[model samples]
Target chain A: MVKEKEHEQDAEAGSYPTGQKPKYGPFDIRRYSPTQESKEKRKSNVLFFVALFAIIMLAVYGWYWYNTPGGERQVVQLKNALAPYNPATWYMGKLSQAQDIGNVWSAGGGNETLKGVLFDSFKVAGSEEIPQGSPVVFAYGLKLANAVVSKLPLTLSCNIKDKDIAGDIIPSNPLIISGKRITQNARCRFNSEITKELSGTVEVEGGVIFPFSTTDAKLKVYFTSEEMEQSLLSADEGDFFSYLGIDEQLPLRTAYNGEPIELGIGVSTENEQPVVLREGYNPLIGITLNNRWDGKMLNLTEFRLIIPKELSINQEISQNPNGLCPFTLARQGKTTNEYRASEELIEQVSLEKGRLRSFECWLDVAPELLGSAQYTVKEYEAEADYVYQLPSRTATITVKGVAGKETGIGEDLLSPLV
Target chain B: MGIKPIAIACICLVSLFFISGCDMLPNSIPGFGGNDESSVGGVLSASIFAPSNNGKVLSDYPFKPIVKIKNAGQFEAEGQTCITGLDKDVFSVFTGCECKSFKFEKEGATSEFEPISLEFGSYTVKPQEGDANQQFSAITRYEYVTDVTADLCISNDIYEDCGADPDAGGAIDAKISRVSGGPISIEGVQETVSYTGGSDTVTLIFTINARKSATGRLIPESDLNAQCTPVSADETPKVQAAVREFPITTPIRCRDAEVSADSTATIICEAKDISLINAKGQAVFEKGYTVPITFSLRYFFETVASSKFVVS
Candidate 1:
C-alpha cells in the first residue's frame, strides 16, 4: 500500500515510474526546470554557429573582391612601382627618352666634344660588276657625332664625274635625325662621345652603265648645326626653330683603289650565221674583252670560257707559243667544258682604257653532235665570265651539221698554227 | 535560423561572379562581334587561285591561270597583272600583251564578299622529253591614291591655345584628323606658323611624308610601263602630290615629291601671306580657326605572288 502511494506521488510530480530512475542524477533539478548554466550553454552554441556562418561569408566576399578588375589594377600598379628595379625596364625607359635629352642639352650648353659634327662610319656595299640598265643600290652607313641637339635634316647628293654614267639620287628629300640612336652602351648615354649610327641606302639609277665602265662617284651629305635664339610664342608651343647659314657638305668618294670598272665579253665564230660544223672540219672561236672605259688601266684578275661538251679543243694548235692565248681546259659539268686562263697569263693581261684583248681557239666538232642524222641543226650554248661579272652573257649558236665519215684530212692541219 | 536562406544567398553570389566573368572575356565568338573584312589593311591583295601550287597538269593540254584579287582597303584599285616565268619554247605563245588590266571598286562593308578574279587566257604546255616543274610569278601593279586630311589650328597671337600641349620645344604641331588606310601612309605632319611684325599675313609651312611598307615597291604614276618589271635605274619613283584643298583663299604650293630608296617621300607645302582677316573684313586672330588641309598622293604600287606547278 505504501509503494502504491509513492507511485501515485511520482505520477503526480510527472517523474519517471516507480522502479525507473531519472536520466540525470537525483539532484539534477535542471531536467524539470531550466538552469542558468543550461541557458548559458545554449547561448554559447548559437553564438558559435552564427560566428561560423559569418566567417564563411567573409571568405566568399574576399575571393570575389580579389578577382575584380580593381584588384587587377592594384596588382599592376604594384608591378609598375617596382619596375625600376628591373634592368631591362630601366634600359628601355632610357632609350625612349634618348631624344628628350636633346632638349635638355639645347637649353644648356652641351659637351665640348659634341660642338662640331663628326662622321663616324661610311661604307659602300654592292656587287663588283654592276650590270647595265639595272638599278645599282649603293647601301651606305653614316654615323654622326651627337653634337647637335636639334633635328638635323641631311640631304644626300651624289655626282658621277663621267658624264656618260648619269645617275640621280632618288627621293632627294633631307634625312631628319631627331636624336635616334642605333647603337648604345650598357649605360645608355647618348652624346657626342658615343657615336650614333644612321644608316640609309641611296639608289643611283643608271649609275653604272655600258660604254661608261669606270666612274668616279662622289656622295656629299649636307647638314647644318646652329644655335638659335628665339622667343617662345607661348608656354604650350613646340620648339620651333629655323635653319640658318649654308649647309656643310661631307664628300665621300666611292672609288676604291682607283675607280669602279666594268668589263664586257664578246664571243665570235669564223663562220658567222648558222655555224656549220663537220666531223673533219675545225672552227676557230674568238673571245674578246673590250674595256670601254677611258679611265685607269686594270689587270684582268680572272676569266672563264664555257663551251658545249660535244666540242673538244684542238690542243696541238691552241697550246702556248702558237695559240692566240694560253688557257687550261677542264670539264665543267655533264654537258659543258670550262677553259680558264693561267694566273700568270691573266696577271700579265693589263687592259688599258678603251682597249680590247682577244683569245682565239680551234674546236673539233664531235660526231656525237650529229648522231646518225644528216643536216641536223642543234642549238649550242657558250658563256663567259670575266672578273666575276654576274649574269654572264650566254651566246646561243645554231650548229648545222652534215654527217660525214671520219677523215684524216684535218690531222695535218692540227699542227701549231698562230 | 534555417540554412535554406543562407544557401540561396551563397548560390546567388556565385552566380553573379560567373556572370560578371563572362562579360569580361573577349567577344571573339563568331556571329557575335567578329569583323568580316580582312585584318591586313592594304589597297590590294592577290593570290593564285588556279594552277594550285605544287600541283600537276598534263602536257599539250590547255590550262588557264587565274588570280583572285581583293580590295582590302578603303580605296578603289586598278592594275595590270602580268604572268612571268612561262617558258616560251615550252608553251604556246601568248598573243598580244602578257599583262591584263583590271579595275575594282572601293572596299565597302560587304566588299570582302566580292573578290575579283583575273583569268590569264588559255595556254597549252608544249610536250617535253620528260616531266618538268615550272614556277610562275603573278605580278600585280596597281595605281592607288591616298588622301589625307588634317585640321590645323592657326593663330596669329602667340598665346592663343590650339591643339595639344606644345612639343618639347614649345612649337605647336598640326592635329591630323584622318588618314586613309593604304600601303602608303602619311607618317605625320609638322606645321610652322611664322608672323612678321605689322603683317596681316601668316606663313604656314607643312611637312608631310609618304611612307610605304616593305611589301611592295612604289613607282611614279607617270612611268606606266615600269609596272611589271624591275624598276629601271633612270626611272625614279615619284608621287604626284597636290594640296587639293585649304581653308584660306591663298593658293598652297607643294613641291615635287620623290620616293627615296627607303620608300619614303617628304613633301613640303607652303602658303605665304595667308590673310588673317576673313572675307568679311573680320579679324580671325582673336580666336583660332581650324584649317582643314587635304593632300592627295597618286602613285603605282607593285607586289608579286609566286606559284609552282608540274607539267607531266
Candidate 2:
C-alpha cells in the first residue's frame, strides 16, 4: 500500500510518459498552425481563378473571329473546302462595290435562276500614257465565280459582255437593256463535265477592257442555255420576258471574292502634261520605261502607228528607221495609213525600268483642198506589242488632233516590200 | 514563355502572314482558262433601194428613187452621210445634194429619203413597137465618211498579256476612222429619168463614164469641179456664126478626175431640145442630130460609226 501510493504521486508530478510534452519538427508544427493553413488555401484559390479566366478569354476570342466579316470569310473557306460541290457552300470570299453591271445572269440552270453573278475580282493590269485626248487603256480582268446547279442540260452557253456576234452566225438584232446594247459572244459546250467544273472549281474569265473615259461605266455578261440563245436571237424585250417565264428584274445578281483587285496600271511620263502629235510635222515620240506593272520587264515585239491619210510619216518611213524591224506601210484607206513596226527592231528595244527610248520619225502633212473648217484635232492610236516580264502584251498611246496633208501616198506606193 | 506557349504564339504569327499573302493571288486559279474578253470589229452593212426597185412610177418625169440606209451590224451608226449624184443631166434637181448625214441609234435600224423631181422643157412621147420598153438607166454615185472609237487593251507584255493566248488577242487599231470611199461599183444607176421630145427635137445621148478615182475618194465632186471647170462666157453663141463654140469654154471637161484604181462605170445622160428657129422661121438643123457631151465626177464623202467594248 505504501509503494502504490508513491507511484501515483510520481504520475501526478508529470514524471510519466503520458504527462510529458512531445518533440515537434518544423513541418508538423506549421501544418497544424491556423495562419499557415490559411495562407496555403489563399494560394490555391488564386491559381484556380487565373486558369478559369484564361479559358474564358480564349473561348470569347474564338467566337468573335468566327463571326466578323473577315472571320465569316474564313468560315466560308473552311466550309467550301469540306464540301466543294455543295450549292449552299457557294460563297465568293470578297466582293466589289460596283454601281454599274452589264447583262447580269445567274449560275443556276433553267428558268429558276440564282441571284447575282459571282465575280472573283476586277483589277487593272497596266496603263500607258498616250499623246492626246489623254487616251489611256485600262487593262482589266473579270473572273466569273462558280454557279450552283443540279442535273440539267448537257449544253451550256456563256456569253462575254459587249461581244458582237458575227452577223453570219445568227441574223438577230441587238437586245437593248438599260439603255445599253447587249451583243452575244456565245461559248457553248455540249458536256456535263463542263457544267460540273464550272460550278465546282472552274471559273469563266473575261478580260473586260475599255479606254479611260471621263465617266465610270459598267460592263455586263450573259449566261444562257441553247434554248435561251434562240429566244435572245428571235425575241424582243416583252417576248424575251415571256420566253424566260418571268417578269421584272430576276433575282439573278453578282458577287465578288477576295480583296479589291489592284490593277498595276501607271503612266510612265515624268509629267502629267498631255502631248499632241501634230499633222504634217516630224516629231520625236519619246517613251520612258517605268516599271508600273505587276509584271517585270517589257519585251517589245512590235510598234504600230495608225495615221490619218491626211498625214504621212516618211514615205520611206519604213526605210528611215534603223532598219532594225521588218517594217510595213499599208494604206488603211485613202485618208489613213497603217505603219507597222518591224518585229526585229521591237525585239531590240528592251524597255527596261528607268530607260528612255525615242522613236525619231518624220511626219509629212498635206492640207485638204477644200480645207478643214477648223484646226481639227484627231486622235491617232499608237500601239506597242510587247511581252511583260511574265508574258507578252500590247500597249496603246493616243496622239490627239493631228492634222496632215494628202501630199500623195497612193496605191502605187502601197507595194509592200518585195 | 514556356515551350508550348511560345510554339502557339509562333503559329498565330505565321497564320496572319498567310492570310495577308493569300489576298494577292490571282482571282482565278492558274489552270482555268482565262476570261473571254474578245471584241468583235464593227461591220458596216449598207443596202440601197431605188424608185424602180420598190414600185412602178406612173408618169412622173425626173422622179428620183427613194434612198434607204440600214445599220445591219451590232453597232451604232453615227455621223453617216449618204451622197447621191445623178449620172444623167435629165433631172433638173438631184438626190442627196451636198450629202445627207444622220445617225442610227441602235443596230438593225434604218433611214430613208425621197428625192425631189425637177425637169425642164417639154417632150413628146412616141409609143414603141409591141413588147419594146425603153427604161433609161441613170448614173448615181454614193460616197460617205465616218469616224469610230473603240476600247483597246494595251499591255507592255504581248506574250502573256495579249498576243500569246487566243483569248488575249485584241482589235488592231485603225489609224484613219474616216469611212469615205466609193461604195458604188460597176452596176450602173438602177433607175432612169426620161424626157421625151417631138420629131423637131434633138435628143442628145451623153454617155458619161463615172470612174472612181482615188482623188474623188478624198475630195468632193463639187470642189473638184469648182477647181477644174473654169467659168467663161467665151463659148457663148457668136451672133454671126451659125453654131458657136460649145456653150462652155471647154466643150468636155474631165473635172480633175483621175482613176487610182482600175474601175469604171457607164453613166447614161439624155437631153431633149425643141427645134431652134433663127430670125427666119425654120428648123435649126436636120433631125436625128446627136451630139456627145461628157462630164467627169469626183465625189466628196464623210461619215462616222462607233462601237463600245469593256475589257479587264
Candidate 3:
C-alpha cells in the first residue's frame, strides 16, 4: 500500500509514470528549468561579452586611422607636415631701361633683304660635335636662319664649361661654302616684297673651325633655350632669346660707342620703312641694368643685344659681278634649309685633312626686279671681340644610389664611409 | 572573475577623459596675437612684422623688423613709364635687359605693390627653445622668394614720346630748348622727375628668420611693456637717395608738356629723374629727362607702377 501511494505521488508530480510505458514515452524530453537568480546571471554574462568586444574593435580601428602608413595622407606618412604653407618671394634680377632701336615698314612684293646689323655672334654654353655629312646650322641675331649653312666643307669645333673640350677656334684661310638655297623677298606677310628672288649655289671651298664655346663661362648664363624644334615654321632667333624681352622683329641697338644721343622706343617714316625711333641714324638697344636676380618680370637684368652698324646688310649697293656675294641670301626665301633641298644643295659635307671646311651653297638673285637695285655684299666678318652671354639654368634631382657603408638619415644623403 | 565588468568600467573612464580633454576646434594661445599658431610645445607667428624682400630694413638682423610706408603722395602711374630705359618694348623688359630705373614711393598708397608669391623655404635657430629673461633667442633667418612677372605690351600712342612715360619707354627726340613760363612744372605734373646726384641703386638683400621660439619671445613690433626698451619695434631701414644724370641721352621732345597753356608762361621746372625704393627695397627707377617741360597750369602726373617686364 506504501509503494502504491509513493508511485501515485510521482505520477501526479508530472514525471512519466514508472509503469505508464504501455501508451507513451517513460521520460520527458525537456531538461530541468533554472531558478530566477540563475536566469538573470546568464543575461548579464552575455551583455558583458558584447560590451568587451565593442571596446576592443573601437581601439583597433582608431589606432589604424592614426598610425597607418600609405601615401602623404596617412598619419605615419604625414612627415611633410603643414606647419604653415606661407610662400615667400624671391628677387630674380632687375631690368635695364628700354631703348628705342629701329622701326618696321610694310614693304612690297619684290624680294626683301634685311640689312640691319649682326651686333655680335657668340657661341655660349656646352657645344656639340657636327659629324661628317651631318646637317648643321648656326643661330645668330637677325639672320639666324641664314647663319647655319649646309653642303659646306666641314669644320670641326667643340665647346665645354671652362674649356674642358677644345677645338680649333678659327682655322687660317678657312672658308666653308655649303650650297644652301638662297632666296630673298619672302619676309613675313607684312614685310614681303612683290617678286621671288634667286640665290646662286656654290661652295666657299675652305675649312674654318670654331673649336670652343664662349671663352668666359662667367659670361652670365642667361635662361636660354637652344632646345630646337623639329618643327620650324618661323626662323626667329627671338625664340632663342626668349629670356630676352626683345622680339623677333624688335630692332637691336648699341649702348657703347653708340651715337652720343640715346634713342627711345619710337618709329618714323624716314626711308619709306616705319622704324622704331628712326632718325636717319643707327639706333641701339642697350641693357638698362647690370644687377641680376631682381623681383621683376622679363628682366633684362644681365645682358642686352646691341646692333652693329658695320654689319648692316641694307647698305647702298654698287653693281658688281658678285652682286650680293651670297646671292642665295639676296633672294629672300630662295635659300632655305627647311626642306631637304636638291642634292646639289644637300651635297655631302665631310672633313678633309683633319678639318671640315668648304662646302656648296646657293645664293638667290633678283635679276628680274632688282636690276637697277642690284647690290653687292662685303666680306662676311664676325665680330672678333664679341662674346654672347647665355642665361643660367639648373635642375635639381633627388639622386639615389647605394648608401654604402655610411648610411645617413636623409633619404638621399649618406655619412662618411669607413 | 570581474574581467568583463572591470573592462567596461575602464572603458567608461577612458571615454569621459577623452570627451573632457579634447577640444577639436580652434584655440588661441595665451597673450599671442596676429596669426599665432600654437602647438603643445610652442607657437608660430605669420605676421611678425613681415620684412620686405628689398634690402631696406633698418638693420641686417632685426628682431621683428618690418617696413611700412605711410602717407605717401600719389603720383602719375602709367604702365609704359615704369621700364622706359630699356628702349625695348615691354617684351624687352624681362628678356635679358637689366634694370633701367626702379623707383617706388615709400610713403602711403604709392608704395603698395601687388601681392607677390612665395616659394618653399625654411628657417631655424640653434637651441631654439629657452627662457626670455635668461637666454636671448638666436638669430632667425628666412629664405623666401619674391619673383614675379607680367606681360609687356607695345605702346603705339603717337604722343608716347612727348613727355610721356608710355610704358616706361621713350624715343630720342629734339630736346626742349627752354621752359615755358607757366605755373606748373613737369616734375610732379608730367612725370615725377628727380635726378639722383651721382647715385646708383646697389641691391642688398637682408633675410632674418625667427625660429620657433621655446618661450614667447616678445616681438619688437607688438611688445610695448615695462620691459620694452625705448627702441622702436618697427625700425626703419636706411633708405638712401641721390640725384644723377643717366647715360641715356636719347633726344626727347616735350610738345605741349604743360597741361594748361594759359596759367604761367614762365614756370620754372627742372627735368630730373625721380627715384625711390619699392616696398621690396630695391632701387626701382632712374628716370632720364630730355629737358624740363613747363606748363601754363598745374597738372598732376599719374605714377605708373605696374610696368610689365618681359620674362626671358
The best candidate in terms of lDDT: 1
- Every candidate's fraction of true contacts kept comes to 0.00, 0.00, 0.00
Q: Candidate 3, overall lDDT?
A: 0.22
Q: Which docking band does candidate 3 fall into?
A: incorrect
Off by over 4 Å in 3: A1-418, B1-297, B300-312
lDDT by residue (A343-399, candidate 1, tens digit) is 677666654443455667777676554332211222222232222111111111111
Model 1 residue A47 lDDT score: 100
What lDDT would candidate 2 get against the real structure? 0.30
Position A417, candidate 1: lDDT: 24
Per-model DockQ against the true two-chain complex: 0.00, 0.01, 0.00
Query: Which residue pairs clash in candidate 1?
Result: A205-B233, A237-B170, A237-B171, A238-B169, A238-B170, A238-B171, A238-B172, A239-B169, A239-B170, A239-B171
For B1-312, candidate 2 gives per-residue lDDT tens digits of: 369998998999999999888766642332111221111122233222333221332233334332334433332333333222221122233321223344545322353222222221222222212221112211122233222121212222322332324342322221221222232222221111122353333233333333432211222333222211111212211101011122322232222332233545444433344233434756443333322221223233222111111110
Tell me the tens digit of each residue's lDDT in model 3 across A289-316: 1111111111111111122122222223
Model 1 is docked with a DockQ of 0.00
Chain B vs. true chain B: TM-score per candidate: 0.77, 0.24, 0.17
Write the number of the candidate with greater lDDT, choosing between 1 and 3: 1
